[model samples]
Target: MGASFCSPVDERCTCSLQSTIHAFRFPLWAVKVSDFLEMLGPPRPHHRLQEEGLLHEWFPGMFVIFTSHQWLSSTHPDPQGQQMEVLQKALRGMIDGSLQVHEDLVARSDRMNLSNTIRQHIAEGFLFFDWFAIPQITVRKDGVNEESVKSAAALAVQSIPAYVELSNVFIALVPELTHKDSSALVNYASWLSRGWCRAELWCRLLSNKIDTTVIVIHSPTQAEFMFPLDWQHNSIVNGNFTVESDRAIVVQLGETAVESKIQHLQVHGPLRDCRFYCALRPKLLCQERADRTLQKFLEDFRFGSLEQAVKDTSGMNAVMCAILSGDTGMLRLLAESRADVSRPMHGLNDLGYYDTQTPLMAATKSHQDPAVLTTLVELRADPNGRASNTKLSSLYMCRSAGHVRALLEQRAELEHAALHGAAALAGPDTLRELLSRQCDPNHILAGRQERFGPLHAVALFSLSNRHAVEAAKLLLEHRADVNSRSSPSDEFLWECRKARMRVVVLGFANCNMMTRLRASMSGISPLGYAALVGHGQLTQLFLDYGADPTPNDRGDTPEDLARRNHHYHLIPMLATFAT
Candidate 1:
């Protein structure tokens, strides 16, 4: 593919011999701003400017950089002056081998192995930022004007995916920012809310590769890394500013992700049912999988065996489809062919996906009949496989469907994740079974706290009165710690604050009228969160169990949180246990 200044978008510009695009050469060892901007040969070297289509194939070592609009300082001579300063500092640190820009916090908890990939990219790679790489006529020295480069710039926008695909890592330079508009833009939420930003994110996540890395730079020292699954829940739902065109692009992106592994659609959250809509979209768009049909699926799919098929293809198998769709005749036919019942699936059913899970996990998520689970268990299918990716178990997935009993009977491991998940999601009977099986009601697990007991888990998920009352009663009966020194969920509370900011930005007549907000919800207890969320009965229960109503690490009492959130009714009850 010879470099052709092909004008797919403009008529004025031709592949004129005189026209040349510029790409800065920055060695990973020592990055000097001056050296990076020096004029190269007349024609652009090995690197393809964003104007050239399918650049990722040519420049597979480039970095797909992401940042907030705040980085574009309007007051600076160059809008990207601040961003360039930060990048220069980062490059210098990398050269000195002194700075390890921390990967996103969520990546640390994921199984994607993203941290290592980012480390490699930072140690040796190139940059593909549009601001510097794509020549702006106004900034160019060759007497080029905006009109002269209009077609190329337009083509550059169309080549974003190629740029992203070729890149080694997606670096999001997100600082804690407060923009003037705040309309779909505030801090990390700001980058997440933008349509183009999401398109870039999707390009990386829904790519043809596995274990992709996304680096988040909160500050020069506080850079974090994350994987696609870590951000799927928020990314799928937080599109308040997305237009119809963006939605169409998102649907195409999602289809590509799903085609890689159908279970990719299982990730969802509590925002506007967008996850469901996004998943169902490919079907309406008539998007077909790569293999086209079931027979072709089996013929072309590569894996070790039936078990590996479930693991690799994520239950996109014809036999699994039959089992999931309740086609008993088809299932029987497959069974007659010596189908393995112990095969674990990594796919999505109606409810969710269970990564590294057995057929029992599938039956559990799909809410299949008790008979289905029984057949698998009787066939010696292991119920020991946990849903590692989801951080929840097949047993936990079965909670809302009341299938916990069957799993308990089959002896699923009553581990910390299982117990904690049950604490948040299961009923009294499920909790009783778990406790009877030697699952500790006071088991310490990572959540809001580094190691919170089951009671703390219950406090966060107690939205319904029946769930709150019965589950709390069961835990307390089993000697649950009401005054457990659990750390409050600053992460969740911060997200709440971001949601509030979005409300203020889009709701208020003038966003500037809103006062500056604080970001420290650091030390809330079970009682404090309960009070803040306005759960009066749960507060009384905590008080009954002798939970101290004194001030927490942040010096705010349950009474204070209750008053702040306007749950005045809980104040009298909480005041009874006064500090």
Candidate 2:
């Protein structure tokens, strides 16, 4: 029989046929929070949980928490029960209002919080952990009833997305842990790279749930709402899998999720969101680009006419659509019809392209062709324009040497901030172009309170860039200081306090206290920034270059920052290089 299909808008629809089979063959099992707390000693298997009468059938409004994580071993997900301990402490903290779910450092503006209502629900919730929910028959040596056991295991695996959709909260239990067999550091980064984890993430984010926020638990005391850009950058098609054969199946699942999300939004009446999803559908699916005619484009984007498209200045306006679609001719046509080439973006923050960013900035960040940048400039888009929210020039968003050249040719000002931005966001080619223009690698902004150099910028902002190491190396080769410290002005601290007070006044949780405290403090060296983010390769590179591990103004050394952030894997390395 062909694969069973279901409407994405259906609240009770299962996306896959295997998940439907799973309903009868292997039901989704969960454990109550109170009962889970009572389980003593090592982590138990599904059979033991069922035997102990701890497993319960998940039902509507049961407040199920679906956990996504990386396996620590081939046979066991948590060989040492370390992850379980962290989860237990975190849950207890949530129930008692001790553990505050903070926003990620980069997502302070999102104002994410775990409300008391949700906390109450979590206090009376059930957990769907794969180890405790799925049959662990594959690890058994005996082959008795092996086919039935294998079938059950496969069905459970396929039903994971359905379970995720049924849950109220999604938690990524990514506390820094060591892999048993490979001795690899299994943490947030490693978990993000796993194929199965990405599938679970897509399932939840693309689900029809009203609140699809993912809580990433880094340590017992530290948890944050995930930055949307993380999932957007790490597509399931690019995720690593233990078995290569699983790639095809998982990729298919991802396509279904994406399609379902787009269809649901299209039918649902948030026209702006529908347009955003439709425009990004190709990129999300990893499909080859197929150029569309202007007629087809307007129809697909739900525009009544070309005039309607041109007059709009929303997030996915005519100019933005043309830029994303890679149609330079359409961009020119829109400009000719009085479309504001310099209009700031709005209502697209969920996709990581923030508000107040110009079309030039979006094009630069999206790494569009150099020709696209040239076309925008030729159409009178300001090359030196800065985002109103961030005060960052379009030059700061350049991804490649060509982008820099395109902006520079239009007289985009090359200053210290440009070098800092290039080191953090761009590749080696872009950094090389900026340095060749004699941009100082260690030039601290004289007036700004956040006077950070190029090296410091790389450490703080280059988390997702694969070219971060090479970009940093380029700066170091240009004589950037390995131990240059940040000098936050007193005004910076005052402003931070004001911002915190504003958050309090607005009745939002102060989820950025840690980040604010770090920012207000002065004399944080480049090494400290790297260690704060647990960038192993960059930290080692700084150590190899003789970076001093001396404590900063707050008396927190690089090792202290690493340990505080639960980067235990970096402890030995930092200790060996400690001054």
Candidate 3:
């Protein structure tokens, strides 16, 4: 078992040329899940595993689980064996059918389940963790044979994509933990921003495997299929790399992976997916847009003619293509050719754009150029159009001050919705613009049952935005209440009950599930909302501004919310404030 090697010439090996060469040099290494679970005190180094005769070379039909994670310490992946403990328990629960992976919260309606086949695979699987598979010279600097070590390390580094492609399952181990050196909170958001992590993600998602589901293990008890839009938002070119020079190489790898995916989809006859990828190719590659003639545009996007393109209102229709490609001229041409600029988006819910999103809304949410928004408005796009599903206007999706100005210039309303939206989704510049226009930072919707304000909006929806902290600070500076509370009315409770029934129907029940539901449906403070989502920075910010650690209407305090969600790292901080 330990001496086997998967043949690089196998028909299943469809890695790129560069990846193949590197893989051929180093081959893939893994350790059986059963063996790994038994021999763990602290995370053992690769050499230690090898010396114990535990490491195994990959072979055909072997079930491989590729684990991607961030290092918590400078010299070790997990100095306290915290991550390994979680993995161990998760694996145990999975094998015993105690743990069930579900879809993310946004897509809970899909009710994607962890198949019994995957559970069986986990029972007899091998894990390909970086620290356990690759040689670690960077941490062990005093080792002998420096030159030989460098050669082997380089080979393993370059072969990562091949290993990713070969794996049967991809698990992102992104438990919220604090970085020992930088004290930064490392979680799903930070993991998504990493360049190498993105590269690996693209490789696995783009692979020719039948099942490309990415299981994101947030905690031992909280694992879900990754949201598709998470990868689309975190482009490899925009990822952060510890060594800046690795950016170019990793970006090239990303391009190859995307191109490979597109080709595979083209042959596989998922024509809708093929068209979507073709339309998003340039944006994904971060390439400069070149002027395209009408015929060239039609051909590049695989449209039969302008009529077909204009009439289609699917996720990647002609209007969407133009918006995503940054082709404003083409956008005007489409509108002139009878394309509905305000046509609600369809079939893109998986990508997070949501249904009923108009072209202007899409452009705004995507952080497209200000010129694109101006052009859409000039082309008679609805300046105040709202998504039918969420009732959020395009103004609420403004990513910058330019977007706000463009909409306002077209007579878009500057109401409480705009301030709330900007507070949760936009940066300081956009908030500044709205505040200058005299939008009330503390205004609650008149005659509305939900008491959600701008501050509450910031707490609930700004988890993924890098500028959220700054946006919250700006709102506070503009006299927004630091201790704003959200008190849902009877109507709101009815709505929550309906949603809760849906969750119950989906078989999503746990020990404290009712308590959590009650707390969420009842009134909650901004600090409570922050703790609920485990936004460490936002919680700290709210505490610094004198936010009270009071319980909600359901008698669940901020600390309770944090613990219910398995945000253990936040317990200490919230406890300090509670005391």
Q: For each candidate in turn, give its C-alpha RMSD to the true structure in angstroms.
A: 15.3, 5.7, 5.5
lDDT for 346 in candidate 2 is 83
lDDT of each: 0.48, 0.76, 0.76
Q: What's the candidate order when arranged by decreasing lDDT?
A: 3, 2, 1
Return whichever of 2 and 3 wins on lDDT.
Answer: 3
- Encode model 2's per-residue lDDT on 413-478: one tens digit a residue: 877678777787677898898888888889885545677788988887545556677888888888
For residue 42, give model 2's deviation from the true position in Å: 5.0
lDDT of 1 at 143: 50
For candidate 1, give the lDDT of residue 381: 65
Q: How would you encode candidate 1's per-residue C-alpha lDDT over 478-568 as one tens digit per residue?
A: 8887777554354655553663465356532111111111111345567876775456566778888878875655566778766654455
Question: Considering every candidate listed, which one attains the maximal lDDT?
Answer: 3
Q: Which pairs clash in the backbone of model 3? A: none
Question: In candidate 2, which residue ranges exceed 4 Å CA deviation?
Answer: 1-25, 38-42, 140-144, 426-433, 436-438, 445-448, 462-474, 496-520, 575-579
Q: Give the clashing pairs for model 2.
A: none
| Best of the two (1, 3) by lDDT | 3
